[model samples]
Target: MGFCSYKSFVILFCLIFTPLTKADLLSATLNYHQGSYSEAKREFLQLAHLGNADAIYNVAVMYLHGQGVEKNKAQAFAWFSLAADFGLLDARDTAMLIAEQTDNKQPLDDAYNALLKQLSFQWYDQQLRPELNASPALHLSPERRYTVEPKYPEHAYKNGIEGWVWLEFDIDKSGAVTDITLIDSYPEKTFDKAIINAVRRWQYQGNNQTLPYYNRSLLYHFTTYKGKQYEQSFKSQQREYNEKISDLIDAAEQGNALVQYYIANWLSSNDYNATRLLKYHWQQANANGELLLRSAVNGYANSQYRIGANMLRGKYGKVDREKGLNWILLAAQSGFASAQYRLGRELLNSQYVDYAPNKALKWLRAAAEQGLFSAKRDIALLLFDLKKPMQQVSTALNEALAGDNEHPQLLLLKAKIHAATGNSNDARKLSNSALKEAQTRNWDQSSIRHFIATLP
Candidate 1:
């Protein structure tokens, strides 16, 4: 190996073995900034594992470039998301490249939620509470805090409307409303529009003088009981989405064939959070099997693929890799493209079950033959790992993203491959393309930025 390669390995080894001190981390970062990738990677890895989100994102960059470690998209994504979760803004920005590889929302949401959770605003309801006065005299004063009350049209909600509309808004210092985000609403756009318009015009008094002010989440539960009773309550609907998602998740947990099959796929997709979109609506169709078991037995290929994946990952329940392999194999054999790709992956990952690279390759080839982009990508990675025929693997990446246009994963892979071939300009172009795609989709730009930083 070359001196740079040997030094890179040493740096990576030190990063994994040695605990990173704050000063050491700073030194490592400076080394990285000064073009010492191996040293920076080692220091960043240590810091990343120590819960430093920035370090995690930096480590992801190292992985993306194969600077001091082997380039691995999966590892990079995992680290990027971990850093993003730690409130590292850059990590959140980089997650988009990985998001384009698959329709999975796990990485995207995982990254966004990581930063969001660390914020005081995330637990605003819990952290920022109304300060009640010590005496009864306080009760005599007018209501200070903004109180959200929904004005439901008496006849409208009673006539047909059901479900809840959740609104997230910022309360300005002057007690005025701004930046109103409609979080969750009935699938009906008309209903959502009505609620948003009405809430925008409404204002509330600030809560006492001490409370400068913060954002508030208001849930308008437009329920119709009996024939004409419409009650609109000012409760947070955050729990409703939680509850509904929870119920579907429970059904998924229970091994209901339909729920099992689709839940993982839903969790994987961008709109998996039950956003008001057609994709989620399709998920609802699969989830409907909760009511009828007989119907659930026969769902779509996507649902079956998801269930098989969850079972393989042991996410729904126990770690029954054998059963998971069987289900995935079954789905694959049934001509489900996604299932075929997953089965190939399961075979590739199966170490305890058996070590069969040839068998894994066979399945991967089968999936790739059918134009499964993920399978093709995985195949490229596997080929690269084996140190055999990498040029073909690079070419396959473009084919993987053939019709989908500029997919982030494919673009990143292209960037990596181009950089490996000494085409710095091409690598930079691909990296920039990936960055633009990620930004347009609002996935995460940090990872992409990190990639750009490494370019010659």
Candidate 2:
């Protein structure tokens, strides 16, 4: 906290006050920076409830050093352990020291035991993602009870900046939108704030109880046509596009990757009818798709990803599995975080790509290193499974927990690790906790239960 440069403080202030970021995170950081320790602590507590790792770590730090709060080592230890379980490196180190100190007083490894207990406790996702994808058995993404519509940006409307932005977010167990990432935006930053603000006000019924979070994404399209505007709307119609289609050809020709993608998008927008699960690829040679192909050839990572993804879906043309994977790999190799994550995830989970644990770990590690929270969590599970070094396991696990503390895969791996280390009590505790959480998340728990039975 004290080591930040003036530039860092200025950047922090920008992140805190930036309209595009969440208000709670903004307020909390502002409090921290303004020497309002107690106020910051309270705001950070609010973020912790949403399962934000940074907030959890801040709260732990406050308790550890008594900044704006009374010093309580046990409280600090618990909070730190929780944060560590979610992959907070600082928290992991501090929690270890606190654990050691606590145990020395007890003449045993009780501090470590306490730390282990904290680790075993359920770490909520707080809406970064759903540990459980919606399936027949896993009833997630409950019906929307209330949704606050996002306002169309006046500036955008006036300027005829009409296109869509891709957004991904999670509806928490309590049916609140927690984590949101702008996957892509057309016309760059025009309507990002508008779309994000609107999505945040949405509320869900959440399975009539506290079900696990649900991961969802949608296209927030801003459209202006015939000199008329609509106050931002969600649409699945990829073919029904904006009026700016004619202007993108020049931008695409200018070698702008973003513009190239948008140009390709505009050109191909009306060609495919994926909405009906039908396609017409043999009908004509369209410049829209050709423009995209050219952009892909130009080594634009975003275009590569888009083209790869589009081909995989057989949207713009026939399904080109080989070409699709090649583009995806190109994008991934170029260090696109999303592409790296997608490639890594496929390799990790045996998706369309073959399962290559080592490769998956490497690619995922790359993405995680770039600050992709989901990738960090995924790598922790992958690393643990690979039986890599213990330090690595601990580090990856701690990092992964920051976003998804109760991830089922991580829990199972931790349980196995505890059992291998001969901490039978800890193993049993974590195993039981894992099963309960998995069941609550409506995950397939047969494997987990089997593992538990084999443990002494």
Model 2 segments more than 4 A misplaced: 1-162, 167-182, 187-220, 224-248, 266-288, 316-319, 349-355, 406-408, 428-456
**Whole-model lDDT, candidate 1?**
0.51
Query: lDDT, candidate 2, residue 331?
Result: 81
Q: What digit string (tens of lDDT, one per residue) describes model 1 on residues 1-456?
A: 321132110111111222322323445666877988877776665444323445566777887778778876666776676666556777766765677765766654564455445532224223221112111122211223443455665545444434456565544434555445453343335357667766665555644551223224454555434222211321233344344555554443332333443333222234222322223433543333232221112333443343344444344444445655655564576565656765666566544666666677778878778766556766766766666666777666666677356766568777878888899999999899987986564344665678789887
- Could you tell me how far off, in angstroms, the CA of residue 208 lies in candidate 1 after the best superposition? 42
TM-score list, all predictions = 0.35, 0.47
- TM-score, candidate 1, is 0.35
| TM-score computed on alpha carbons, candidate 2 | 0.47
Q: What's the lDDT for all of these models? A: 0.51, 0.60
**Candidate 1 local lDDT, residue 143:** 29
